[model samples]
Target: MERMKEDQDQIYYHSGADLESVKDSPFLEKLIKKGYEVLYLTQAIDENMITQLLDYEGTKFMSISKDNFKFGEKDQKEEKEKNKALKKMYKPLTKFLKKKLGDKVSKVRLSNRLSDTVCVLASDQYGYSARMEIIMRAQAFADPDSFGYMTPKSKIMELNAHHPITKEMLRLVESGEDDERAAELGHLVYDTALVASGYVMRDSDYKSYADRMYKWIGESVGVDPSAPIVEEYPEEEKADSEEEKSDGDANLKEASSSSADPASEDHSEDSSEDHDELLYRSRTRVEDEVFMATVSVF
Candidate 1:
């Protein structure tokens, strides 16, 4: 964070350029001693390591990224409230689209991820985010655009009340009942979201969707999806990283005194997926508890 520290307005001190050069600043030392709050933004910041470094510093280390980027919990509440209204509007249309797509896609459904707009083509758990795809394409590292083009992943059609075009659409649907225009509009909304979510639009020509959106914008103040964000951090996110270091030293002593087993060393190595990640690990910990309990007179 040495170079990045100067760019950050709030950062007080810059540690030297490299990891080996990193040492606690005298200023940070005083702050931690006084029980003050410090937010670490380093990309190299590891929680496990911090848990092991508490001995001399007597400080706590908490991750700010987990607090900031934690979206799963918030999405759950929004999902419940919006999904029903969305399903009512788009469910039939989604089924129709599924038939049109045929063997091209898995299945079609109404999106619970929609807030004020309609549709989003989301990937499953391990799929790449939009920005990540751009990097991969720039480098030509992965099958750059092969899986992107060929994947039969489908878009979920999500209809919303607050949407300007959608408000007009609901009125049209009510008036026409079984109109061809309403179905066309439904297709347009779904296609728009697909493009927005970094997927190729289903329609090569979106002249009608463009005209509809333009007409709506011309009549009103225009659509702005950027909502006012009120930031709140969870208290559960706070943990004492330094406590591990003091515990590590004491545990290491005990482990060394115990009868050495070559098998135990091999087992420890096999358990940890990362060697560098184990650098901050406190000695034996969960294993010690299990060993102590198991070896008791039975």
Candidate 2:
């Protein structure tokens, strides 16, 4: 509060894991670049604590990551007019993103808060902050039933219409020739914004993000994403397999030849008879030993 300018009536704050993280957040790029003072709330309890203290000394506390955040009142009209023009210009792109992102985002719109960043995810005014959601999720892990009622509202994706990637996406969306590519790009941007805004992505969302990333990487390297990966066996491995097969065939032939020989069959029958005779003598000797031992004990 002491750091606020004389005319500043709003105390802007951002919640994050640490000071460096909140300071380097994409959500604060435009605000920071414009010389706006933002309080970096890094403690686990800061978000929850700030909610209770809504206002300090008549200066309202506002999170820059919320959808209802606004800049100074002096240029409010001008900013709205500019945003209106941009919304109209990028209507198709917004529509495409909304359709592609589905329920992940509450809405897709052009952002006035972004300057250097391509996009960012913003929470609802009264909804949970990204940090709060993280805390709630951690709590839910311990007592799932108690926190089952806690469901975070979908985030609002704010895209920088001035960014080159956004412009290219707009073009891809307008052209309709690369609808699939455009959809992939839209999903990629949304997933990136989710992480940038410090929200945990669902399993399916992460899977889609990984698939898109791999596809783009493959495309960049001139590889066909749809092509099947074929594993090639080495010449040495093939030679070894053939040698084993040949050895098995030779062993099988030798066994068959030995089984077919009359002399070998006679020898096998003689060996069986001799084995039975040896077993009979061994049992008789054991019985004799047991009788002698019993007599001595008596």
Candidate topping lDDT: 2
Q: Tell me how candidate 1 scores on lDDT.
A: 0.46
Candidate 1 lDDT over 50-82, as tens digits, reads 435633243223221111111123443555666
Best by TM-score: 2
Off by over 4 Å in 1: 1-82, 85-90, 97-113, 141-153, 161-164, 167-178, 200-298
The TM-score values for the models, in the order shown, are 0.35, 0.76
**For each candidate, what is the lDDT?**
0.46, 0.86
lDDT of 2 by residue, 1-298 (tens): 7766555568999999998898889999877766778988999999889999999878889999888898877545666888887899999999988887778878999998899999999988877788887888786347645554444546799999899999999999888999998998988888888888898888666776887899999999999888998999999999999999999999999999998899989998999999999999999999999999999999
Q: What is the lDDT for 64 in model 2?
A: 91
Residue 218 lDDT in model 2?
92
